[model samples]
Target: MVEWFVGVQVVIAVLAGTAAIVVGLAGVKPNDYTLGATLLVEALLVVQLVMAIIAPAFGNVATGSGLEFWIYLVSAILIPPAAVMWGLIERNRWSSVVLGVACLSIAVMVYRMSQIWFVQLA
Candidate 1:
């Protein structure tokens, strides 16, 4: 993955994580603004998924073993939506809690993804 994209993802992840925490702390009422912002984070992941596929396809080693990296990228893409869906099923503060946790986690996955690519590149 490009450094710029990782930078963006990191920035958004931090912001979304903060928003999630705020939402969770404020109680069960869903904030439209926060949800909108959260969707942006997911959208960013979706972009990462697309880029992951393209970068590898073009013989670029954004992450080593392009296909394998994509698998991890795809998993990262799946997690937030699944968490959100699970939250919806419950329809309470816990959903926000899930989202909050998911928001924090993607950053770690992003870092792992970075390591996977860079460690091998080195």
Candidate 2:
């Protein structure tokens, strides 16, 4: 994983998640703003997926378990679309909250992936 890119992803995820949560709490239903934010997060995850596939070819390698890193990366990539689908189907304020929850979860997972790429084990 690219260190700076990981930071960018986490920042975007937090911002998007916070916005979605606030919209939900205000009783706003799933709409363009919320859905768009979720999509933006998903787009970033897709970029991260591509980066992960190619980074090693350029000499960047994970210091931790490759399987663990890939698992977290793949799972994180899946979350936003699932949340967006649920939001589209439900069309409710709680769905917006669900999107928020998914974004926040992705943020945590991305951070874990970064650790698996960069952190040293004993």
Candidate 3:
């Protein structure tokens, strides 16, 4: 788990969340720009996933439950695409709100992933 990579993920999450919220508040339907932001964040998640998979080979094992970490990783990967699909189907301002919530959820999951990687309980 690289600290800098997690930091970049956090920043992307924030930006994605902000974009979604602003679009929602403006009462606009989903647009390509908003969807693209979510897609970009998703792409970053893929990078994070790959890094996590290989981190153990470099001797960077999670201090917390490995199962939990994997669960969070899988959920993080699914969220953006799910939200985007729902938005496209719904075709309303609420779709933007859904995207906002999804982005925020991804941010939380990323933070938890870091905790699982770096924090150990005695």
Highest-scoring model, lDDT: 2
**Per-residue lDDT value at 38 in model 1:** 62
What TM-score does prediction 1 earn? 0.81
Higher-TM-score candidate of 1 and 2? 2
Between candidates 1 and 2, which one is better according to lDDT? 2
Question: Which is the leading candidate under TM-score?
Answer: 2
Error of 1 at 9 (Å): 0.5
After superposition, the stretches of candidate 1 with alpha carbons farther than 4 Å from their true spots are 57-59, 62-68
Q: Give the per-residue lDDT of model 1 (tens digit) for 1-122.
A: 67689878978887887777777777864455555556777898888777766775676575355566667778878887787666667667767767877877888788778777766653
Per-residue lDDT tens digits for candidate 3, residues 34-63, read: 788888889989998999999999998899
> What ranges in model 3 sit over 4 Å off?
none
lDDT, residue 28, model 3: 89
lDDT of each: 0.73, 0.92, 0.89
Sorting all predicted structures by lDDT, with the top scorer first, yields: 2, 3, 1
lDDT of 1 at 61: 73
Superior by TM-score: candidate 2 or candidate 3: 2
In model 3, the Cα lDDT at residue 43 comes to 96
| Cα lDDT for residue 103, candidate 2 | 93
